[model samples]
Target: MSSTPPVPPVVEGGPAGSAPGGSQSGHAEHKFEKWQMKKIPTMWSRTWAHRGKISFGLFLAYSGVNIYYARKQQVIRDTIPQNTILHWRITDGSIVETDTDKGYFQKILRATGGDSPSPVSSLIDVITTIKRAKDDPRIVGIMANFSTANNKTQQTKTLGLAQIQELRSAIQEFKEAKAKALGGEDKVSLIAYTDSFDNQTQYYLASAFDKVYMQPSGSIPLVGLSSTVPFFKTLLGRFGIQVRAEARREYKSMVSPFTETELPPPQKQNLFDLLKGLNSQILADIAKSRQRALGSDPVEKLNHLIQVGPFMGSEAKDEGLVDGLLYKRDCGKLVESNGAFGLAHYMRVTAKEHTNKLAKTGEPSLVVGIVYLIGGIKRGGGDFGANTVVKGIREAANDPTVDAVVLRIDSGGGDVVASDTIGDAIRWCQDEKKKPVVVSFGNTSASGGYFVSTHAKAIIAQPTTITGSIGVASLRPYFTPEFFKLIGVSVEQFFTGSSDTSLLHDLEGAALTRYKRQIDATYSDFIKRVADGRKMTIEQVENVAGGRVMNGKEALKAGLVDKLGGLSYAVRLAGDYGLEVHKNAGHLSSDMEIENIVVKVFPTPKPYLQQIVESMVGDEAVDMYVRDKIHSMIMRVWTGDMMGLLHEVGLSESSFQNAPVSERILDTLDTELNPDNSDIPDTVEVDEFDEIVSGVESVKSLEHDCDIRALCIVGYTRRKSQSNNCCMRGVEDRRLRMLFEQM
Candidate 1:
């Protein structure tokens, strides 16, 4: 330890090279340099000890600066230019409400260009964008791109007719706003372009614009509309399978497909009337839009033209269905020659300017809460998500800040109890919370959708929206022993109770009578709800409640809905009612108008982490999954995908969704045997029939109280062998568990 000698310390220098040790100048300098080098190494070593933390801190700082600059650039890019045209691309990705929540992964994915943008704008966004454009000086026009709305491959569905009408209404509003802004100059324009006008619906939407263009090779399939009902009685009879279903009234054609071999006269007439009404509306709208080109008798001319369709690009232009023929690139150049941006970009750039303006201005504002009740109204949840709608309504009603609520419905109905639960919540919201609730119908809000909204303060719908299916049907399949024998299968059952409603047993005798009584009670309850809500007599409600679907126009006349208008109109009504209530309660002055109404969506999307955690560790998640699967199966049945499956058993595919099913099946089978069709698979194995049924007898058992409204396509899957085995096992497990519980 004492092997080294002590070193002398350097003293402060009086001059450049002076040292306190009284040494030569060069020697002193060398000592000082040695000491400085030692000190520098010590400082560097201490700094290097925290290299990981230092790197991390530096990265965060760099990211902050990067984010600031990127946002600045995006703001500049999204800004509207002079005389700019906003583009609205209508595709299937369009959402009804604003999707405000984006997770960290979503943000990162978008930043890294891994996420593709939605091809279309939603209804609310589209309307809001137009409203903004109408006020902005820089925006001169809008161009709608509906090329992706309808696909020739039948892989994509067209936008709902009612949604198209809503868009049309917005466009009209935009035109009116422009005219007023220019003191009747009407300089602003709307232009529509598509690769091809694939159907009457696409062309119908295009006709709403000032000028319409299509690609040179495009064709307008403007053929007239035809509604086809698929009758399964004949096919089921061949297989010795029976379907027993009861309807509240004769007009409830939902059961006709199972009971009748062909469309009944009453249903056919009702369907014809609906078609005629819709066709008239279409002709009238087209005639009004094309008045300048059609001269006089425009509706008659349009009808004549439709009889001669489908028209090629040139033919359609000559017939005045379209204005010009041009490629998509040229069309884009023509529309956006001055400057342009997507409506989404415009919305993003201007959103900050519109956020809660009432709060900023210190003005008295009405807060309206919007709740979306979309898809089949199942008990746990619908197709929209895992959250029950009742919770959303209760939360909104209980919120002190929210003054009113608007329930936006876009469903074709589901379970009775689910609908009733939502309805009860609505009543409680109004009776207990004293908040006004308005309903806005979108596309097809019928049956259970209408049921839940029966007690709302007001109801609104688009003229083309399908609503008012108030009747109920209990449908079930009865499999005979002969059918089981044909399939080389037999099922044995032992039961002590006489109340069995299982699929393995037929619903007859006392059980069938009891089921009928339950159906009658539900129907009576439905009628009473409607009558009480509308302040109408039972006779009046019954006259319109025979399981009949009506357009908003008919619904208003029949007193089924309060008004025929879009969601915006409904929200305004809700705000007005809320303001009235405030005035009556002495909270607001009578002169205070409902200004700067703020609307918010309920049941906000959960955080990404929370969603993952809940999905991984909750019975709610499992229940939601099961309900979603059942709803999906029900949708497939109603939408005629089941008919496609039965096409394999000699049913004509043409009867299902108007496709040539028999030809497709023959072609698929021939592909295996014919060397020329080498592109297809070599064998038609069980797995090869991806969407086909393995066992038609397999059925999902619902809760005892839930009525069987329709046949659920149980065990539906895209992969036959594996999915069938898994589904069968699950069904067996559930059946055994239920049996044990019963014992």
Candidate 2:
């Protein structure tokens, strides 16, 4: 808080407002004295009468109105930002993720190293944000801001392979869409500009762009891919400590670290297979993207370039690893937009736009609720805390307005009980409510992740989505007498039952037998669920089980997923299923012609209180945060195309007769006019018919192959628009004339 006070307001007719050299005459001074004396009595009387309550109230009211509208105007301005270049920076901090609150704060404290908002590139953030930018006409291009050396927060040698792969996929999709949208003209440009490019993951991501610009004097080193794991069993033995774990199968590898000095053949084969697959995928993506950019086969070039470690900027360009060598300052000039802006500001504007749009279109738009199942699974319901995802699933299913559902799953699996609870909820939604539920995988969805998703209507995953770790294991810790003596602590156990409490201690005899049986039972159940959910045989599922993890492509071949695609593709599939349901219910036309239907997005405030307070927040940071939150909320409601979000609100063939008299007559006219259902009404009163003729005539004059009955239904249900109202008037005129002539 600052000590400074706001400047005072100007007073009328005071010396501060007057010319410097002026002086009042004696007669005029006497008049001023008389006026002041008269005003003093009234001022005192007013203060005494009401204690100045009304005066203070009026002042507050005036200030609040001004503040509120000022904020609103600022939001409006942010929404209409046009011809802007977004400078997006991907930082190490952005990619770092933690599941616990303590870890989140720890990451923030690490800021002593220097903290700036890095694009976290979490699956949804990277994929959806890039997708939004691709569709947003105002964004001309994007440049990867990878100059971390000068900044406090620095990226690690190797970025997360999963994040890099997801981002690269988004970039590729953006370019493809841009090309189609532009009709073979100049495409939406994507450029990678970095101080240095070292990590294989970083190289793979950068290679996806049209041009890769390396900072002059910077190097492209460390192009190799490898995995490292240290054996701690030897060290633990010297310390007189022991560790043990048991699994249902040999390939589980849960106890490998503590039980073996070196990886067994099976475990070694598993690790090698996963790594080989990932490395091949990275190499393939880099080659494909570079080939398109360089206009030649890049397989040989990339393979050769991989062997040469750490090339200078100029050398990298010559070797075809990079397109050019330039400084960050010059890279901005390449992909020219109408103007330049940071990506953060652009995000703020987009959120503001979404909030305003929802204020208007939210009621009518089909709700496609996206319930994100992030983090580990626990025994609570969804509230964005801990690992409660079941409640969110139930909430989406219970909403009457939701036409479809998308469950975005990103987890390595946890807590079988919680996982089963969610699975039951998903099954309930599909079996009882009959709403289509589509599951879209993110970075990881193995173990318990795959368990909860078994009952989904359709499962979709990215080509790189890590899935299918189908097996179970159990661990029991036993304390030795020496271990407690070294720690200077004593432990004791008591039992009340006659059967004994051996289950709490190290297993042996019958206790050990019971533990093994339990483990076996859980493993059997996991296998059964996979077989039933995936529509595979028990033998086939067993072949893929045993704690084996595979990427989406491999999982699809194993029948673990119905299809291999991203969230957007799954969303469209859900929408298709929803549309079919509405059609079957007679809410939509089987053959209704669709032309242009313009809807106003970016709505104004519909709530009375929100209007007063939303624009009044004095802090810019607070405003931006709130605005972005609003956008995130809207995006969750439905993340599909606008047309897919429209559901019938008023008249349908089944309900037309129950509608208002005017709507019923309009529906009759529509049915009579269409050849598909051209049966007209049998009985009509001529006098009543004449009265309705005038209404129909006005609608027929509109230059649209307008559905008059539909217009009449919407008139009673939806808010009126000037253009639509005018067309409605024209339709009434034409319809009446045509009806009278036919009579």
Candidate that would win on TM-score: 1
Question: What digit string (tens of lDDT, one per residue) describes model 1 on residues 329-435?
Answer: 88877765668888787886777667755448777678899888877888764335323577678669867899999988889898898888888889978997899
Q: Which stretches of model 1 miss by more than 4 angstroms?
A: 1-68, 95-121, 150-157, 183-186, 356-359, 382-387, 504-511, 610-743
lDDT of 2 by residue, 297-337 (tens): 67666666667776888787777778888887788778564
- Steric overlap count per candidate: 0, 19
Per-model TM against the reference: 0.74, 0.66
Predictions in order: lDDT = 0.71, 0.63
Error of 1 at 15 (Å): 26
Each prediction's RMSD to truth: 19.7, 19.6
